[model samples]
Target chain A: MSGEGDIKLLGMVVSPFVVRVRMALHMKGVSYEYIEQDLFNKSEILLRSNPVNKKVPVLIHGGKPISESLVIVQYADEVWSGKGASILPADPHERAVARFWAAYVDDKLFPAYIGIMKAATEEARAEKAKEALVGLASLEEAFTQSSKGKPFFAGDSVGYLDLAVGCNLFWLEAIRKMFGVTFFDVGKTPLLAAWAERFAGTEMAREVVPDADSAVVFAKKLQARFGSNTSAK
Target chain B: MSGEGDIKLLGMVVSPFVVRVRMALHMKGVSYEYIEQDLFNKSEILLRSNPVNKKVPVLIHGGKPISESLVIVQYADEVWSGKGASILPADPHERAVARFWAAYVDDKLFPAYIGIMKAATEEARAEKAKEALVGLASLEEAFTQSSKGKPFFAGDSVGYLDLAVGCNLFWLEAIRKMFGVTFFDVGKTPLLAAWAERFAGTEMAREVVPDADSAVVFAKKLQARFGSNTSAK
Candidate 1:
């Protein structure tokens, strides 16, 4: 783990993925140059760094770039090991659990959230919202099981799982307002709701997380493009 | 990296996910009990161990279960570090690359392959097949760039990306035969084709990979259940 050279982050302001990387960097106390990219007209650096997905945030450390937010977060943890709060736990099983849940956020929860906002009809929206609640309930269970009375997913401090799921808070709140539906029920997912609030109230999160108003505006634009009877898939 | 207790794998025979765990175990030369589960009538162990996804390739080490194939593979590398051939590289950047490609296999290639085989009509199948080929081409580029003249994805040793992509070879071959279409074209993906052959021919792979005939049989059954226009998603 060497802090040898310049570090740069290629990202977009609106992306939750980008926010995840920023949170990880802040948690690790690593300094990096942040360069915002235009998603519609992606930069050469972004495209070259991540040709496969062509998305942000790409972390360029010492001239080499790493794509995928979770991947970059893991890289940051390894490269900056022992510098600050450890993102993943020491135990192998616990580390796997962290990865599994992180993957779950992307694989299951995000899609469900998008489905809720993008569904055409009220009935479809309700169904999608219900599905999203199911995913949230599972996440709530994860938080409860992983941290008994601790503040975050990986015990007392914010860790990998927190960064993974916390990025969605802005959009989740916006969807709650726009659709008049409560996905993270206090009765059902009390732990998750509390965790969400705690995560949002953190100084790092407050600084890094996109503004809720701006997030809502972005969500509305996304809905216009990806919502309704259109093939959002 | 202590080898302290009994290791048991709960898995289904036809699963590439299960195969991944098995390959990692064999690469590490770790002794483990392999217990095959019936997907139709899933065992209590499978359900109890991985209640979240309830899918197999759950590696139970010293009574704790680790779900998700790639996650388990990573756990194996960590727990059995310094034992045998390292699955992931030592460098953080290289490890991230390995992880990125492995995730790509799950996120992109597998889905495209499934889409090709499960499409409803010939036209849809052709389109899906083309999409799958596109993914394969990208994989080919990955292999070429990562390993210039080396044998495997990790340059000589059959590492993480090799196992991740190699597990799908059985099903890919089966699809080719069933559909009379060649997805892994020698002309288009010469390096990948050679790598696939090299990987398949490995002694470790011979022991872990499901036989082609058995894979085809399982694929047909899957096709019956998940194929055609009946909500493959």
Candidate 2:
């Protein structure tokens, strides 16, 4: 698995999920072909590669397609054990904690973000925005629980947990602009804000992340679509 | 952690998630005080233990509360390593695959089940039922990709994955009974069906799991409440 190193990734450049996989690869110093996807009309390769999920951030290493962003991150970490970055902690307890937080962010916090972005009315938007704020607050607490004054989510060095949770920061900023609200209070969640700033300023994030302006523009289009939709009513 | 030997679980007998933690502990051979909760009037311990989530299946080991069902399962597996059941696989790749499917079931498939159970209209009910079938179908495909010739999700032995995905089977049955439809075509998904039977019949499952009759009865009560609201409308 390690020697046959012709790695390829299929995903859109704009997706935060795609950026997650990109950041993992960048951190691990893995060379991979980045193929941009038109999600509206999915390519045959993307479809065939990920028949189950049929979503972006599919990693193909030596002809094996690994769907799911976090799963792909684990695969990258496994493949580049000694050569590059170690995304997972060696200790099982620490690794479990990292994974638990990662799952928590994806499962709980992410829905709030989605709800805020898709709310129909200003009232609904505000309600969802408030919930998102609470979720982010819990995440801030998790940062305090695990980091214990460390720089990253897992510890001093960036790991899988950071990439999984950190990928959503761009989406968070876009949602705030779209919904006309700010959930992240930098003063209150100083540690998390610092972590976000540090992770976002990394070479991987800077190189692979969608620009803030473009993300906001994309979010605005989604918001407009939700507004015009009869279903939203 | 093992030497402490003073673990207690606060939860109800009815919740599948509570059963998840119970199964993990049973499999791990971890001894604990099982305190049944009154969901209507929650105990102070339940509230104090899980302040953030304020939910059941809270594992208090060594007087520390670990909230969230899956998190508790992971904690049990880690803490009680020398116990009877090893919930998670030692191999990282196998563990990742197990976790991936478990998350898929929790996030995607279970929501479809909830939608079907809660649908007010016959048309909406049928549509949601169809979605649940599709979710199961995707799981069937995921099994084909990974499970292949394996007996359990993680080979011969039942692990964390079986417990996670298996907990949903009773809910599917309950939902199907409420809607007067069959979701899991035993003839179609033989392996999944067999696996479900295996999991349900396990001593751990038998001890903790409530009968499908009870779940259907509870679901019907909820549906009736909703139906009354619709009639008022």
Candidate 3:
């Protein structure tokens, strides 16, 4: 029977959501073997584990597979509650607020970013880019309130919301480089701009998050395979 | 200085999602003021509480507002952990699995139902209906695995996934009545069909979920305003 020591993660390196799960594992100080699944030819285990989505970032613990990054992250927090700092806040209200913003990152910010890339026309891409900025601006307000001059969204340390949003920083930077659409615009959201810098400089962020160049290259490969609306400036 | 007694809920009676939040509150036996919002002219509290979405159902506790039904439900579970049966399972794996299915209901089944309602063409509506059946079939399989032959998705008592999916049972029944689209098909998904009957008959389900006739009435009102592809059978 598989046990806690037998934890494994199935993921592709470039996916930001996959990166988010990895961050949670890191925060929890849990050791797990990384099984990189080739997206072109998906593994049978990946399909079996997540028959619903067949997507990456499936965490197999004690022979049971848990799918979805946020779900898996929450699972890690629950299972390894005492191993490291809890990913979510101890207070119920605070935890709910954190969850709210984390969801905003997935359901709003990332979609806006993806919308820009997937839009069929430059005008549409520009429109999505504007939405992306608005998303960032909202998060900027959230950061000022939540962080209280702290560097991370979880206050002092990297937490769930931090991983949720911070995982996309490199991708946003890549978008900036490719589309000339800035994410960390200091004039508009100075606190968030600074938060991004501080978050990216964290040791785990350095070790785990893929660089902007890699994200750009991977994105280009994807665009080459499936066309994109905008190209590098 | 507001306290626990200051709980207030801002919601519209017609929304299934809003009912889901109320079910959570009911399950927890948390009494609060129900502030019915005329969505045409949203209240200042609703606007202030949920600046991001500006939608219901917003749960206000001690002057702090939390938006989104699922998020509010989780908050209720956490805050009232000591009271009533815990909404989510104590076991991490169980909790994760429950969350996954709950998300599926929102991200898959509900959308499919909504698609049937909102589709511009009959052809598109039929396609969405087929997808909805496929989603139900998948959930039937999930019910078999997760329930371990128990009645509830949480396995005996009503819990998170039960409420998440069950909140839509009345709406689904209403759809079936209006459009002749069967959800609780006996032959294909006997377990789920049986489970639905059992869940819907539960005291809370009877109390919290709007009756199918009411849902049909609400849906007709919506369609009269917004237009629908499929009319009453």
Candidate 4:
């Protein structure tokens, strides 16, 4: 470790994963230098820090780089323990539930969203859209049950699962506007939708989450990039 | 939590994911009932416990079910803290590295292994085999750096990363035997190969990991199941 309080975040503005790291930092009231990375042409720092995946949202604390958004979030919680809101619960079972949902967001939800974005035909898009909705519905139920009638996934505070899911709200909204598709239905996923709104309204989210208009442009560009791949659907 | 020791693990015998949980339990000396579930025809209890994925290796403690292997491993480490060996590192950066590699095993290495197993043609198999080797080479480098001249990933003890990667040894050996192809070359991935041997020789691995002969039979059965899907490659 370097000197105390040395923290740097390497990420792109458009990436939901990066937003996750930012949200965690914001929740913890921890300050860090944010370095914007060009995804197309990655810098030496990005490549060196995360050699395995070479992906972004690398949290450099005390000169040590921690990659993977969730991993970074957990590291933040541990290192900055007793500072700001606790991302993961103190209870082991509750912590497991948070992790399970976070993994679900990456493993199931995001893939389903990507499937819709990559879909070539209307039929394929519809199928993928349905899958995405189903995933959102599951989150709705989780929020309904776990939130205890609170705004966030883990009660009143925006915890680990909240940051994991809520950080992607901009991207979700961008996709909705760009494709004229609704991934999270207000009626079906009322709790999750409400949580999204509550999360977006937070001071942390206001400061960290990317601008809506720019995110939509990025989403459109991403859709165009995926269009080149015929088998993406 | 339920009672003081009311823990039940729902798992399948041959699954590496299940073995991971078992390894954690064994290391922690946590006594729990292990119920083997049929993957082909999943039981109601299994489905009920893990409604989202409906997959195996669900840790049911105090009537609450925790799905996902890695999540369960972390939970075991936390709940049973100070009881036995700490699966995760105390240092934040070290813990992040462990989590990264464990995630890498799931997100990168396992997929490459699957690609090789699902390859239809010899040429495709050769390509996937090369990719799988590259992944193993990366793991070998990780072991060389992280092992610190010790046996396991987290030094003398078998920690999270060790259990994540090492538990799959039986499946790897089974695939090699069935296909008459080598995935982990002794010369190429000497560290990883040695680690595999070291892991398999351990008392825990010997007791938990399925026998090589039986694993081969299971591999053959899996191949047969995949045979119907011509586009598996």
Scored by lDDT, the top model is 3
lDDT of 3 by residue, A76-98 (tens): 99998988779998889888989
Candidate 4 lDDT, B132-152, residue by residue in tens? 788888998889877999988
Q: Best candidate per TM-score, number?
A: 3
State TM-scores per candidate.
0.94, 0.86, 0.97, 0.94
After superposition of all CA atoms, the RMSD between model 4 and the true structure is 3.0
TM-score between predicted and true chain B, model 3: 0.95
Candidate 3 clashes between residue pairs 3 or more apart in a chain or in different chains: none
lDDT of 4 by residue, A1-29 (tens): 22337889999998899999988888788
- Cα lDDT tens digits, model 1, B74-94, are 999998897889999888988
Q: What ranking of all candidate models by lDDT puts the best one first?
A: 3, 1, 4, 2
Off by over 4 Å in 3: A1-3, B1-3
Q: Output the lDDT of residue A210, model 3.
A: 89
Per-residue lDDT, model 4, residue B184, is: 69
Q: Write down the C-alpha DockQ for each prediction.
A: 0.86, 0.33, 0.92, 0.88
Query: What are the per-residue Cα lDDT tens digits for candidate 2 across B147-183?
Result: 6578777677778777888777777777656566687
Can you write out model 2's per-residue Cα lDDT over A1-233, one digit (the tens) per residue?
A: 23537788998876878988998888887777889898678999999988767899888877777778887887678766776789877765566567767877777778877776666666776787778777778888878877778988778877878888888888877665555566568877777778888988887788877876677776656556555321221
Tell me which residue pairs clash in candidate 2.
B27-B85, B87-B160
